[model samples]
Target: MTGDIAFGAGWQKTIRVGRDYISVKLDDPSFAASVYASLAETDNGDYALIWSR
Candidate 1:
């Protein structure tokens, strides 16, 4: 699956990492590089956003 995130006046693209997570690539004109992150559901039924350097 794929989607878009609204940032300011523009949109960023996102994709599904697996059956359990949705990944998003974040980028900006002022940033040096793009950042990747993923969101997954927790055991308690809440969602968690996971990222690494």
Candidate 2:
């Protein structure tokens, strides 16, 4: 969570509740590509992924 998350962005999301903390990162481009390819092979129809703050 301390590295590049996008073209020029870094460490995009951080959250803490009580004594716990969490950091999130964007999926690696290659991994994302592979996921999309696998999804295509399944022909699961169109879908959408949404993220919001």
Candidate 3:
């Protein structure tokens, strides 16, 4: 799996991971869930304007 942060005003900035497996079995769902949980309370901490995709 791979992670990237992109900032410039316009873009998907999505998390991209390449693998030989099916897309449905992509990056750890648990991991993503943890991440979302951690950030959900940020309340715009992303307001720093840095895009972490």
**After aligning candidate 1 to the native by TM-score, how far in Å is the CA of 33 from where it should be?**
1.8
Pairwise TM-score winner, candidates 2 and 3: 2
lDDT of each: 0.62, 0.32, 0.27
What are the per-residue Cα lDDT tens digits for candidate 3 across 1-53? 89984321222322345212111212244444321111121345432222232
Q: Number of clashing residue pairs in every model?
A: 0, 0, 0
Lowest lDDT block of 10, candidate 1: 6-15
Scored by lDDT, model 3 comes in at 0.27
Give model 2's clash tally: 0
Q: In model 2, how large is the Cα lDDT of residue 14?
A: 29
The local lDDT score (0 to 100) that residue 41 gets in candidate 3 is 18
Off by over 4 Å in 3: 1-9, 16-48, 51-53
Which stretches of candidate 2 lie above 4 Å from their native place? 1-17, 33-53
| Candidate 3: Cα lDDT at 30 | 45
Q: What lDDT does model 2 reach?
A: 0.32
TM-scores vs. true structure, each candidate:
0.55, 0.21, 0.16
Candidate 2, poorest ten consecutive residues by summed lDDT:
33-42
Q: List the residue pairs that clash in candidate 3.
A: none
Q: How far is candidate 1 from the true structure (C-alpha RMSD, Å)?
A: 8.9
